[model samples]
Target chain A: MTKKLNVAVVGATGAVGSKMMEKLVERNFPIETIKFLASARSAGKTIEFNGTQYKIEEATPESFEGVDVALFSAGGSVSEVLAPEAAKRGAIVIDNTSHFRMDPEVPLVVPEVNRHVLKTIPKGIIANPNCSTIQMVAALQPIREKFGLTKIIVSTYQAVSGSGIAAIEELREQSAQWEAGKNVEANVLPVKSDVKHYPIARNVIPQIDKFTDNGFTYEEMKMINETKKIMEAPGMKVAATCVRVPVVSGHSESVYIEVEQETTVQEIFEVLKAAPGITLQDDITQQLYPMPIFAENEEATFVGRIRQDLDNKKGFHLWIVSDNLLKGAALNSIQIAEALLEDNIL
Target chain B: MTKKLNVAVVGATGAVGSKMMEKLVERNFPIETIKFLASARSAGKTIEFNGTQYKIEEATPESFEGVDVALFSAGGSVSEVLAPEAAKRGAIVIDNTSHFRMDPEVPLVVPEVNRHVLKTIPKGIIANPNCSTIQMVAALQPIREKFGLTKIIVSTYQAVSGSGIAAIEELREQSAQWEAGKNVEANVLPVKSDVKHYPIARNVIPQIDKFTDNGFTYEEMKMINETKKIMEAPGMKVAATCVRVPVVSGHSESVYIEVEQETTVQEIFEVLKAAPGITLQDDITQQLYPMPIFAENEEATFVGRIRQDLDNKKGFHLWIVSDNLLKGAALNSIQIAEALLEDNIL
Candidate 1:
């Protein structure tokens, strides 16, 4: 007999959290009960799901008393304090924050790339990989297995929505002001509290987050370290340069990878076409390729522009694009929940 | 004593040619007479320069009879048919087209990097490199000479203005339509005459020119081949992925280079700071870096985000930005003329 589960969503009012709620309803998961949890500011608000009004509750530890599953998209601190509480209350927590992503006990899971991690949740919490790291690894998984991947060099053209809802509002208002021949003001982008803000309308800002001591931005380091951890390829060489573009939702990457053995473009296309969660769009005759605007609202990652390197026979280049808000954050979390259900782990 | 010369600009009404006129007048070049030449469609149009209105003349083989120097930015087809004719009429032609860029008889020149090539023009024509390649090599020349560069991999975020004035108009109109809740009409991007066209508003297009046999677009090939010729490094491994962004003017690059010797970020910064036609904007503490919006009207190539590779000691990364119209096109042509004059070749 099939069992119905009670699910709760933390940070129910954020850019990613709202998408999580929509995806849960759209996918029509086997839910017997649904609870919307948020901070105190949004606790009294009401949202509609399944044609019923559900009042948002403040995410206190007591909120997870009877919840069977909890999906969290709150900030790192909120997850740090609440995720373990939810887990201790017998609810399996899928945390979408960087706080527990690198923790040795907490498993960082991307169901398409690594689904086995969901079966053994010793800490009762699973961490979702960063937005940029999620799509890249999903696109690389098939090739990594077939060709024995050795190294990756990626340059990302990320969207502003990755920063949160305020950043998206800033991009809209700033570009509109520029178009109207008025002065532009920017309060959230590149880094929110970094003491300097740059207008991102029709511009590409190279610094996505605060810089680390080694000169790589924190966002770039997230891609480097998170990719290694998720792929279980700690010895693999990975380098990233993350830049924020004026895009609204989708994130695109120009990925150059070297395999352990030489491979042809045809082999790569076939492998990725059959791979799960990836759509092949590399036909040159019809001028079909992946673009961010088209990737928005899409659940699958789009891969195109596959070509071998001019000088390096073992190297190949690809363009990967996906909805950063969907597969990158919201849909990925819900997919993890579905994986747990399919494996009968919960 | 300085010699005054008669200068003729073909395609005077075009985007780059108009900038050429502005640069020539702004710099107060030693000119006895200035002639504006365009196609028969715009022959009699009058333009003001140096507080004087000069009527544009129809460009023909006889147009260069009394001209000492000719600057060509009119398409590649126009240069293929008329550049040699202009040279035969006692004019030193600085051709800003890919038509003659790879010809053995023609020397591809970037004034800041390889100005010495202007000393001898066997075909009486000096070729200008592609816009994206121009800024990248200018930022790399000083480091390449100091460290002996051997490999380059670049991903470009180029502007729509590089396509022409018509492409710029398309971008503006399409973006306005998109903002007004109408479907975007794309007719001039990624390749105008190609079977399909992608919108360039709030999106990025991977293809810039027609695809070649090896699966690389013609623009990507231009960057790969022209970088070698201009740098005189025929053996250097160059790879490029050209993507057009929604920018109006400046072009930005995420460049990864491998040098022969091991180096540090500080040393590379010192060398670039002292190099001509390069501006260093790397200060991580204050979140300072080069952006396309800031580099739009600038002449110098802005470089920043310098860091050594984590695993490869000889590999380094940089972000390069510059105005595609100035340093990439008009200013480079005028600088080539200056080199020819200074070397007594004109």
Candidate 2:
């Protein structure tokens, strides 16, 4: 018999937070009690879970008092303050924000790639990798394990929903504006807090987040650094060019990787076919490949268009697509808690 | 004083063909007389050029009898038959179709990058490089010329307009479908005649053209093979992953390059600033980078987001954007004609 535990969902009204609720219910997590927490503005809202209504509560330190596990997807600042508080209250925190991901003590995890690191939760928190990083590593870990990856250069076509519900709404509105031949207004995308905003509808913006000193966006750096941390390959070379496309959900990546050993496209396909949490969709004859519209609700990391580089025998190119809200954020956070439960950690 | 030459515009009803008409008028190509030619289905339709209406003629070898310069944007099959016929009748054919691009005797030209190749036209036909390849090579040529070039890896965010005016209509219709909560119908994109069609509204399709035996689409192969040919470096290592996004006009590319010489990001910027036919829009401080929407209808190839690879000093990353119909196709074809006029070849 499985043990039931008290669960708390932070930022319950936000995009990823709501997705966490759906995944928790769909996955049939063993929960004795569940509470929805959000910012003060959304505290009075009622959310339906498991056919029962629960009033959303403002997430303070005390809100996590009786929680055994807490999933955090509230923005980085919210998690920065509340994650430590939740952890201090004896709830294992699985954060989906970028705040604690690079902390030496907080384990940045993708369960299929590096679940063993959950053994030592020094800060009592496991950081969920970035949406773009999660899908790339999930699809590549299998290939990396079989062939040994030495270098990765990834260019991302990320969905707008990765920015949150506001950006998704903006995309919807801008598309309408474009259809009407009106000016496509942008208020929430590229980065809401960034000084400049661009219409993502019918456009691709190369800058995902604010630029770092090294000329990489914070979003690009997260994919670079978190990939190294999760893959446990500090010496491996990784570079990313993250762009925000008009997509509403799934993130697509054109990834070029070089392996340490020789491998064929067929061998790589076979490895991805047998890997956990990956769906191989690479049959060129039938025109079968991954597209974001079809991958929106899927949990698996979908990979296709695998081709060996013409000039370099050791290099290969692949297209990976996964729902940014699912595997990239909410679902990954829940998987961390599930891993904890399966290992008898909670 | 410039010598005016008789010009023939083939496939004048098509997307690139209409753009060729616009470019010819805008550039004031020293024209004695101009005629519009199209397939039988489109014949007898009248098109306006320079405020004068010309009846579209069914293109045949006789259409080029007195024409000194012919620009062909008709499909490949049409070009395969008519381009040779047109060239044989003393019209120097600037073929925009892929039929003659790989022909060893035909000069595959991007006027800014390889106008020198126009000195010899053994086949009496000068081939316009693929649209995607033209923008990429136009941006990379300056860097390659200053620093010896070695390798290129490009992933494209292509516009639906590259497919044709039908794709543009499809994207517009699909956006309306998505807005109305209807199932988005796709009939024209990815490839019109290919086995599969995918929605380009809020979705990115990885396969651009028909897949070849090497698992690369013909579009990707064109970028790879044509870049080597246009750059005149037969041994240059180039790999391309072409994708179609929902943008209406401009094509955006995330390009990674390895140069034979060590170069700083500032040095590359300097080279691009001094280069012809390129506008350097890469001021990170002002949040300025080339984007598809802004690059639409522009003549210059826009380059930005220049960054040196953190792992390799010799490797660098760049974002290149250009109006696919302008610099990528029609304008480039006209530029080839202009180069011929400048060099007294026509």
Assess candidate 2 and give its lDDT. Answer: 0.93
Docking class of 1: high
B1-346, model 2: which lDDT tens digit per residue?
2899999998887889889988898998899999989889989988899999889999988989999999999899999999989989999999999999999999999888888999999989999989999999999999989998899999999999899999999999999888889998989988899877889998999988899999999999999999999988999999999999989999999999999999899999999999999999988888999999999888999999999999999999999999999999999999999999999999
lDDT of each: 0.91, 0.93
Off by over 4 Å in 2: none
DockQ of each: 0.85, 0.93
- List candidate 1 stretches off by more than 4 Å: none
Q: What TM-score should be assigned to candidate 2? A: 0.99
- Residue-wise C-alpha lDDT for candidate 1, range A38-135, written one tens digit per residue: 89998899988778899999989999999999999889999999999999999999999899999988889999888987767888999999999999
Which predicted model would earn the best DockQ? 2
How much of the true A–B contact set does each candidate keep?
0.79, 0.93
Top lDDT model: 2
